[model samples]
Target: MHRGTNLPAVGGYNQALILDVIRRSGEGASRVELAEKTGLSAQTLSNVSRRLLDEGLIRESGKMVTGPGKPRTILRLEPEARFAVGVHLDPTVITYVVLDLEGHVVAHSRTRTPVGTKPEETIRRLTVSVNAIIETSGIDATRILGIGIAAPGPLDAEGGQVFNPPLMTEWHNVPLGASLAASTGLPVFVEKDVTAAVAAEQWMGALGDLKNSLFFYYGTGVGAGLVVDGAVVRGASSNSGDIGHLIVDPDGPLCRCGKRGCLGDSVAPVSLVLEAIEAGLVSAPTGELDSVTVDNDFTRLLSLADEGNGHAVVIVERAARRIARGVLAIVSILDVDRVVFGGPFWDRASRAYLGVVPGAVADDPALMMTHPIRFEQSKLGADVAAIGAGCLVLDRVLSPKPTDLLI
Candidate 1:
């Protein structure tokens, strides 16, 4: 008989493998297929499958034929076995996604987070929204792994605390995770939204199979998330990818980080729009940061540029060039081979960056000596942060380890 993976720190290697396999397979798989892929034996797979089934993690459907003897039973992940809550706390609005074990979003909910929304009120709304989702979905509370929060950077991921998050003012050293945990009575993890996007991309995005990869997340704010050697490179403070603070220009403009010429200050959407207006390139850039969500603005910018809007063209191009400079630095230093771009602002950035990046790198004497980096759209869709936030808990429950039985 095979043993169960319930050890501490290591988590459930078997469960993780099985769940991840199903997560990626989409249409689902059979026990024999899983066993073949994972190298787990028939009896061991049976044990694992039993536990998963008992916990409603998977369900048995019909059977498929291998040869002439007997039809093998098909096993699939029970999508509704459990639920995970994902919250995207942007500046003006709150988007919620309730995902089941199969990574299916059963219910989506959103609300406003106005200029001076209190932390306490936000937490209350979150709890109520979460409970309402569960109440509506009829998913038992016990089965909920917990809530995975995807918020802006400058946060302590491990501690679940916020530290002067760029967009959300009046929040410093706030125990975001702890407060949410206390209120909901569920395990809560607070992650930089960019990192969450990277996670989502890894399993479903353009970075798949690229172990050493860089994900440039451009949204309401700009940041980077790195997967070095197939592991999340959450630097010394668990806040490594807030590259928005990276100083790209020494004497350019003021940054939210109290510095001048930071890349974010140079190229973030807020900067681009403001610069366009100030340059008299745009007449009335009346679009408020909160008015157009990242997704919408990105689309609009792309459309405007396509329609021959000179101001939009310049604003987007400049941002793309600045982005290229920042990306080149990382690719050169890390010898990274892949770069996937996504976020609310990706549509505009993608079209513009595609032109700027290759040229920028090709012109660089250093990268010109090596193979060019590959840049592409996120394989993951718009709901990356929310999906990846849910997958975070799923990862904790499923990631592999060294001592697992291989065949």
Candidate 2:
């Protein structure tokens, strides 16, 4: 729990601290409860509560009687008081979501990502999409906090630049954040897609209660998002979760990095579709295999595996084992007891991967952890990363951080 100070200069922090407690209290909380949870003095709590009520951030619900004393008034958060926009820039798709103060997704939109387009043109289209979603949601523009973008890694997070993600060919050293901010006239934050996916899990998914966990993101590429001691791990460059190059299979598919059996190349959707085409499971497209074609073919491959096609099942099972191998290596090092799975391509592969991954991890001879590990599918669904990107805005504004109390 975050404590509040009565210092005059820190009133903003104190109000945020109090609101954090009230928002998490679910049904509602009384002044006494807020005081106990946040360690705020009655006078300070009263002042903060008045301010919150005046700002329409919280409201007094029906009174509740605890004992012989007067019934304490319950205070509840006004979720609609603030909103945020999150945008996820995937290699194959662009996802946008509008999230309320409570981190609930109120609106969403998705479009196929443009291929072979210049970075400037892509950013322009993205700006148009963001504006359209906000207008369609009918949210008060004044209530929006900001926009957050989750893109592929190798990001200059501090500079708000995308430093050439492997999958996004035209995005070499692009200032995505500044460009979007300029176009939309809102504050913009850029984060690695894997990092944002993990943030989404922690903020709105089942991983919130767990202190240590891993988010195994499956999309056009594969990566891991790490959380240790209840905090997302952004490494020195803010590109922490690139587990793609991990060598999982010695004789598997050759990767662009000139290596064979890398985790990413072995399990990515495009790779799977290509393999299926090679194995006569899926017909070769007349033209080049684009992201959209790969997406449809990947779904067909999964459907074939679901119907117990021997060749398709073998391909999926091999991919699952390769993913399990990569996951085991990380879990052994990080000692995280929980692993979450989600992303654009996760839904198609969930049943097959889930069936194999857990058992493979558990049965591995090289397993390190003595305790049992838990596996869960993301409840936030396919739009999780986008929702999390929006949560970035809410988290920045509402979550009480110790740094806020610095002198």
> Model 1 residue 100 lDDT?
76
Q: Which of the numbered candidates is closest to the native, going by highest TM-score?
A: 2
Q: Which lDDT tens digits does candidate 1 get at residues 228-252?
A: 8887787887777867767766776
TM per model?
Answer: 0.83, 0.97
Name model 1 segments beyond 4 Å from true: 1-44, 67-70, 135-142, 205-207, 256-259, 281-304, 366-369, 400-407
Best candidate per lDDT, number?
Answer: 2
- Report, for every candidate in turn, its global Cα lDDT versus the true structure: 0.74, 0.91
Q: How close is candidate 1 to the true structure, as a TM-score?
A: 0.83
Clashes of 1: 2
Give per-residue lDDT, candidate 1, residue 228.
85
Give the Cα-based TM-score of candidate 2 against the true structure. Answer: 0.97
Query: What lDDT score is found at residue 345 in candidate 1?
Result: 58
